[model samples]
Target: MANFEEYKNIWVYTEQRGGRLMPVALELLGEGYRLSRERGEGAKVCAVLVGSEIGYLAEELYAYGADMVYQMDHPLLKNYTTDGYTKVMTDAIKAYKPEIVLFGATHIGRDLAPRIAARLDTGLTADCTRLDINTGNYMKYLTDYTTASSSGLEANDGNKGLKQTRPAFGGNLMATIVTPNTRPQMATVRPGVMEKRERETGASGQLVKVKVELCQSDIQVEVLDVVKEAKELVSLTDADIICSGGRGLGNAEGFELIRRFADKVGGVVGASRAAVDSGWIDQSHQVGQTGTTVKPKIYFACGISGAIQHLAGMQTSDIIVAINKDPEAPMMQLADYAICGDLKKVIPELIQQWDEEEQQ
Candidate 1:
């Protein structure tokens, strides 16, 4: 068994592409900072930055709550390779021994986190929506967010281990997992799930340059070139307003109206899983637990009944406007503004009013 006591700080994998830090990396740092404060033994929030010539990105990590940064720069690591990144990340974990390790649950993160966990013989909880270091906070989260009953829930005030909570069994249940035996408890959090702390301009931190030991023999596949896809997709995470359609739209053609409304409001188009599964829209537009988690400023759910799975993704939006015929629908209850009517008629009227207001 590993000595859990030797672990010190919390480590976040600050993932970047094209020399730009992913928003999820900043989100994790904010969470790591909170966890460090909760752990309360001089536990710092550190960022692990890996790539070639990316040493300059460390300062931004510091500005966003990273107390220290581990820079692993190498030519071979410019593009993400499972073998190259996994080896360096695993080596770093073994050397530094962090108490907690976090990764964003993006395509690359999902691929990379599991490999490092397997290599280190540690446990990793993937797609975690909530993370807590305090037992009371964990239980409170379960009470507020999950359907779990308090009848059997026992609270241990002394437990400071990371408690990772995620949706389970096709979104029907939530499970809280803990790795008490592991030195560094690891988890991959979905994007837009955690809130980012405000950046402190000119903030500085301790920087550690990690020596990269890699060769061609370690990697099986060589990335000759990266071709960006020409398809245009809306960035739902960055959108301030989102106009989404669901199965109640009745047909794929319903998305056309959703698109028009989205265009009018300068918002992006989003869809419930039902609409995407029914071929109403591309999977890229899907917004839900199994899809992308979003927290837009305004989320308009048109013709959606608001199932729990759908709510899990967008419930955190700043304001929700639900339009459905059923006043008793779950979305109506949760919505800040609930409109009971046919979305076909309601949306067009809303568009007309918005246009009239603009004209005046």
Candidate 2:
């Protein structure tokens, strides 16, 4: 019953809003490039842009490594509501079949990827941190009859596994999965996790524009008015510097000190999970397995206990500075520079020094 006769290439769901491409689109393009190369075969990394007059953005995808661009320019697709996007994308997938599909783990992606996979009856590995090809499993998906047998993606070749890796077990471990039996092995990768390819001017790829079927009844939500978030979007991902404090601060008032230090340094204030879970700070300020992953130019850990969950999020920061009274603390050991002094004293002095330098 599956249309095994159709489809080729890898697909990254190009989510466009306000005429700008999100960073996750670029990240997937980077990974797709490497995965295509590993196969030692030419596989088009396609960008599926579904919306109104979004064809102009298709060429930009090619600069980021897309070999082909599929555009579904429709009037009903002007704005994104779950129902509308899923409809158009599903239609496109049924038209031009792809091997692997990637989506950003942001709000829209988290909402869309699973639904699309369910409708197509395909296996999807969500929130992947890494991706690679495995030839050993290519034949396995074909012979291995399971949930993956439903999607019409089969090559009469040997096994080539697509490995997707992500952090698991509360960030205590990492897990790698292979889609040995599914067509368009889908995944939702975290934002800011992968590097974006360099965009080039005048780079072009093949374009296929398709008209999709749509009805007003298909749209579930009606647009009232659009609202924008506050001017400062709290870009923890792009933060140049961060100041984090944890349970060592011990109480709510302690964060005032941390906030002051952060304010002086023109940095965002971050907190360990313990501090956040204990209700000392806001959820957005928490850093760790359940928090935002950051790679700031400088990250300061103050009065914090370094649990692996907390470290998992900020470990990848460019430079880590820590101040813990207990010199033997795990965070202190991992810090690029560790201070074994009381934060109550250290913080004030540092602020004073920065002030003096500013005045001079």
Candidate 3:
């Protein structure tokens, strides 16, 4: 068994691409900072920065709440290779043990985190929506968020275990997992779920440079060139306003109206899982538990019933406007502004009013 006592501080795999830090990395730092503060044992929030010539990004990580940064700079790591990154990260984890490690559930993070965990013989919880270090906070989360009865659960106030909560059974249930035996408890968090702290303009932190030992023989696949796809992809996470459609639209053609309304409001088009599964829209436009989780400033739900699974994804939006004929629908009940009218008629009227207001 590993000596859990030796591991200290929290580490975030600060993922970056093309010299730009990913938003998820900043968000994780925010969470790590909070966890470290709650743990209250001089546990610092640290960031692990890997890639060639990326040491310059360390300052930004510090401003975002990282107390320290582990810089791993290497030419072999300039472009991400599974073998190169995994080897360096595994080596670093073994050398400088951390109590907790976090990764964003992006494509690279999903691929990298599991490999490092396997190498270190540690446990990793993937796609976690929530994390807690304090026992009280964990218990409160279970009581408030999950449907499972917390009555039967035992509480241990002294347990400082990382409570990693993730959606299971197709977003129908939430499971909180812990790795008490592991030294560095690891988890991959989905983007847009956690809140990011405001950046401090000139904050500073300690920087540790990691030594990299890698050769060509370690990597089997060679990336010859990266081809950029020339197509417009919907960026739901970055959108301030989102106009979404659901099964109540009745047919795929209903999305046409949704698109028009979205265009009018300068918002992006979003769709519920039902609409996407029914071939009403592309999977890229899906916003829900089985899809992308979003927290837009304004979320307009048109013809949606608002199932729990759907609510899990967009309930965090700043303001919700539900347009459904059924007044008793869950969306209408949850929405800040519920309109009990046919969306077909309501949408046009809303547009006309918006246009008239603009004309003035």
Identify the candidate with maximal lDDT. Answer: 1
Model 3 stretches astray by more than 4 angstroms: 143-156, 230-233, 250-252, 325-341, 357-360
Report lDDT (CA) for all predictions: 0.91, 0.81, 0.90
lDDT string for model 3 (284-344, tens) is: 8888887889999999999989877888788889999999999999999999999999999
Best-to-worst lDDT order: 1, 3, 2
The all-Cα superposition gives candidate 1 an RMSD in Å to the true structure of 2.3
* Candidate 1 Cα misplacement greater than 4 A, ranges: 143-156, 325-340, 357-360
TM-score of decoy 3: 0.90
Q: List RMSD in Å for every model shown.
A: 2.3, 6.5, 2.5
Backbone clashes under 3 angstroms, per model: 0, 10, 0
TM-score of 1: 0.91
How accurate locally is residue 38 in candidate 2, as Cα lDDT from 0 to 100? 65
The digit string of per-residue lDDT tens for model 2 on 113-151 reads 999999888878877776767544433533462233424
The C-alpha local distance difference test score for the whole of candidate 1 amounts to 0.91
Ranking by TM-score: 1, 3, 2
> In candidate 1, residue 232 scores what lDDT?
62
- The TM-scores of all predictions, comma-separated, are 0.91, 0.83, 0.90
